[model samples]
Target chain A: MTPSTDSPPRIYTAALAIIGNEILSGRTQDANLNHLAKTLNGWGVEMREARVVPDIESEIVAAINALRARYDYVFTTGGIGPTHDDITADSIAKAFGLPLVEHPAAIALLEHYYPPGELTVVRRRMARVPEGADLIENPISKAPGFKIENVFVLAGVPSIMRAQLQGARAFIAGGRSVLSRTVSVLVGESKIAELLETAQGQFPDVDMGSYPFFKRNALGTALVLRGREEARLEAAYDVLVGALSAAGIEGHPGELPD
Target chain B: MTPSTDSPPRIYTAALAIIGNEILSGRTQDANLNHLAKTLNGWGVEMREARVVPDIESEIVAAINALRARYDYVFTTGGIGPTHDDITADSIAKAFGLPLVEHPAAIALLEHYYPPGELTVVRRRMARVPEGADLIENPISKAPGFKIENVFVLAGVPSIMRAQLQGARAFIAGGRSVLSRTVSVLVGESKIAELLETAQGQFPDVDMGSYPFFKRNALGTALVLRGREEARLEAAYDVLVGALSAAGIEGHPGELPD
Candidate 1:
């Protein structure tokens, strides 16, 4: 299905910043961003941009300055750890010119997990929060996340991060999540080029893409169709499928096009 | 691996930015960071920070300004699509105070993909290059990527971005990679918390983590151990494993404790 000239068009926006040395060292694979994107999509929030920076203070500060000013809500993961490298709170504070002080609420939580004086230099790192920032609670762990302005600074550890965000969810913006559909075809992407061109022209409001993959040694293509308007997207998707059927290509009816 | 106490540890760095309005709109899930991280880890480069931005010019410029000055390399993906929202090229050029030029190499590659002038205003968006940047060749599509000072501009599509990266690998730094190991334990993370704490104390050089996961619907913990000093790390791992084995903990004989 495709959108006609009479239909209203669609758009989305998002900003993602991943903070971790483990990810950069090629030591670990990060599955969080993609997961976040999918979840946001379900809620109709667009993830507009993503950035990755290191564990350095200056670097993190600079990145915070850059993203906070550009995005509706800047989401950062990875550096809110109980270690020396966990400098996100201080960084965000520095970016906003706020004072980073040990918050009474966070200190209470810290004491629950760590006995007095057990929270060493590294562990104490997790308790510091900037002035005027609200706490994003962590049900799994005692240390809470903070939301200053619109930047939601969460823990880098997945479980802790998820719990904190769960507590912070309602305050975030909700949008009309656009619809998506997929059309798979056995024809080579090169062969399906003309049809893709036609589909795109026929439905300018919808985004149509041809992803070619190799399965069992033969070239296969998956055409992904997406749009904000449901009826228009459905229309363009149907037309794309019809064109694929006419071309004698066969695949699934509705898997992700990519 | 653990770092030798005597040797000063130096951390490698990187920055990532995802550019696209679709991502913001929750229309598409991004798989590039994980894939790219896998590649980066092979070379031991650490991804310090990441951000996602919408298809806005000033936003991209602002991000570029902050990241370029702080990290060894800044990577940007997406927004090079053949659509009105694809304004990455011009913004990148503008960010560096460089003039936008019809890059000869990129134009030639585009010509090879679709005949000269067959590219409309939308498609031509992929061909814009900032002055003084080297083109990064796209293996999936003919359109190439370009590199400015400390910045590698690649495609938004995963396959195309990956192919372009393969073409850009030679430009990475030549630092020796950080090494790590993983040991699985058939026990809950809480049960092993004491041992983990003890082991970390004994092997201060190793960074230890306990990751819990479900196998056959049963909970198990995987200890990921990382560091720079090979011998010290190996020795610590052995001692840590020995202690666990003595305590009836099932673990690898030589898998260093993380």
Candidate 2:
């Protein structure tokens, strides 16, 4: 939602659509989601949701359409390669009801990257893009990713996708960045659930979470408080630490070392 | 859709709903999706889609409702702990339009696990589930997960979730297992796209995928063929290897050593 002229800054949101059968089939572990989430967070864009869909055209189209409608921006990874299973570009075109065509810039890039007479028909498939789309630079490889409206299509390879994301930084409009603080204690989550509930009630604006961890066979819980306002986050952290101390538990300032 | 009594076995499909803020915030990398996908696949259930949603109640309920309607079985992990941020139980109840009530078996489990007078009200929160739900056993910890209709709820921690999933095995009905074979060629995907395409056309029953990788500074692609019938999958693999050999590239039998 847009903010009023005198209101506070509006928070930007994004969603990721991972289009690959390898991920859904357990053949390949997805490495792009965490990197994308952290990168977007640093730019003040919150990644609100993500979906891993197979290479099926209908599934990819539906996921792209659903995410683009709800989030400020939608990004998709995978299905843009030259192989037969790489159907991301065509699926995205279908999702937007547009025709797929060869982009002149993409073709020129591919032609220049490959040796003379080596850019075969199948290799040139990477030059195809949805009509009326802008190309996102791929530094690692000659083939470029494309952007159409609110959806940004990226490669599935982690290194190439990270490079294209950097090129996409110019297109994203960021808002106020959310900051967080963490406190860890050598106690299980259930041991401090009531205190955490009370602290959460006291600071309703700050989003709090408790994650249980096992360190050297000792059970512990990490309490994290996140908010856009630094002052509010600090206050909440202090209150949480004070409550833990009152209950005769030592709350470390940060997460325990592994 | 069900198969005829005399027809071949039907392939069962499942969808996962991962509920957590840590995953979306980039604080935690998800470790459950791949494990669940592999486990379900081994049991002859294909993981068709997965969604990572925040801990918001509305989002959780919406994701659950959407996934459950489309897949044969739906699984959810995270947000079932005792902390205030844990709201999966309530959201699931809302999704099914059922009342949230304390399960007697769950209470007994928790009471038996914790020390005397330690199972406080907040600790007892884990015992609450949707009305008319069956309990899923937790081997590591005493807090039990629950199953309501087609949806199975598990914990966020990897070890605990894996244990709970083993307990859920009895409730699932599996189909024919999908088998796969991989051949790695020391060439980029673009170099062999046409050959792979032709091979895929020859064996339409097998699901083919090409994944490019860079190992030891050498570019290569892994060609994978999957199908329910072992003979068909092997034939596809043979065709792929033959195509690569005709193209003057050696095809390794399996994935490249890491």
Candidate 3:
């Protein structure tokens, strides 16, 4: 993949591919993407793309190939379970031309979780990992995750997936923390246009945004200010609060002031 | 754009671009893509791709150009609010070489929502919809959304965006509705291999999947069956339920068997 040429501190982008028919069917309100998005964004990595595909081998391979070449990292959720339809491991192996073998690290983790005497037939598949890949520790369940190239295959279940992500977070490179602050007001967003514009200019290095939430009950629109700069974030935040005060709209500094 | 050399199925495909800094900053968890995903799935149209881009003109345009050319439709959320940061209308117009103009239908809706002099600043900006685009009525805010080519641009907030989506649902064409059924069992997903294998063979056209979720701290798995054919869906669902029962795990109709 060609590297990004221009730079103003480029965002480290990743694409999330959620492979499950359940999420699309509305049976499982998938929270993995949202969780990953917030986590990656906080680390200053940009979640550029997200897609959900059914549990099809061809589909999975296609999506992995298509997305991995573009983004810095490609994370997949679902279909790593011990069930018959859990074909993500095989698909990843095929995509990377790697042999489907039990990695020593994964077998150890799986064995630690479910010993030979206590092992169920279904639990045996959890030990298999693609050859030449490192095991991604599953803090919640010992069914370890694995990586191939830029793709990190994970479980579909939110709880386990989040745990796997936490273990894998430190491995992600090119991340810088972006501190955020918010200033919400009852004043309509358009009423504070000049204030927001001034704030943006004042903090050119910081990426500033104004988000207006709906009026609570019969109050008014709440315009929340956000940016990366701490002092400027607070300063712009103060200016926004003062603008709301001038407009007779009461507000306070909060992450999400209602 | 060249049509897929392969056969075009009854299913419709779309890509979603969520243009918002609110979502990126973790200030607002985006519900638009998920809502649209479920809605589109119900309608039989597949949501192929989704991206959460900041309200930047070049980024928005590039995403729209890439996705619109690849998928059947592109739906963008956010950047249509009353705030100066709401750049969706202007961006969409610029993307398609369409001129930005005050849309009459939108102006009428905005005028009805606010008293004449109350929100002139807000309503005035909302009135500026691109020329040659149709209005997507907003029952919540009276700020009508716009549709250009295959791109449908809507609001960021869940409630208002949902309202606009209801108005625009009919406009989607050539997409297939996704039919899914589930059989939940008290047993974990690992034990359901034979049943899952049988379910897959019986329902070749339909995509069958198993999702295990913890309800009240109990380990239970849902054998979700999804397909386009009603008869296939019913047949597969029945097979799944029977397989579960035979495996000593109970399965019943109408959601998962408790």
Which candidate number has the best lDDT? 2
Model 2 spans > 4 angstroms off: A1-6, B1-6
Worst 10 residues of 3 chain A by lDDT: A1-10
Q: Give the TM-score of candidate 3.
A: 0.86
C-alpha lDDT of residue B47 in model 1 = 62
Angstrom error of the Cα, residue A65, model 2: value is: 0.8
lDDT of 1 by residue, B58-124 (tens): 9899888888998788888876655444578889999999999877777667677776667554455
Sorted on DockQ, highest at the top, how do the candidates line up? 2, 3, 1
> For candidate 3, lDDT tens digit of each residue in A208-252?
566666545543454554444466667766766676677676775
Give DockQ for candidates 1 onward, in order.
Answer: 0.25, 0.86, 0.39
Better of 1 and 2 by lDDT: 2
A255: Cα error in model 1, Å: 7.4
Q: Please write out the lDDT profile of model 3 over residues B1-258, one tens digit for every residue.
A: 223354746667887888886665555667777788888787767876666677789879887888899888788888886666788888888888889998877777767667677656655787776788988876665657788889998878788789988878778775557777766777777778666877798677777677777886788877777766677688777777777777777774555533
| lDDT tens digits by residue: candidate 2, A91-129 | 999999999999999989988988899988998888888
Q: Considering only chain A, what is the TM-score of each predicted structure?
A: 0.88, 0.96, 0.81
lDDT of each: 0.71, 0.91, 0.74
lDDT of 1 by residue, A51-110 (tens): 666666787787778778866777888766553345688788998999998777877777
The whole-model C-alpha lDDT of candidate 3 against the native structure comes to 0.74
User: Where does model 1 sit among the CAPRI classes?
Assistant: acceptable
Clashing pairs in 3: B11-B176, B12-B175, B12-B176, B43-B177, B44-B176, B44-B177
User: Which lDDT value does model 2 have at A72?
Assistant: 96
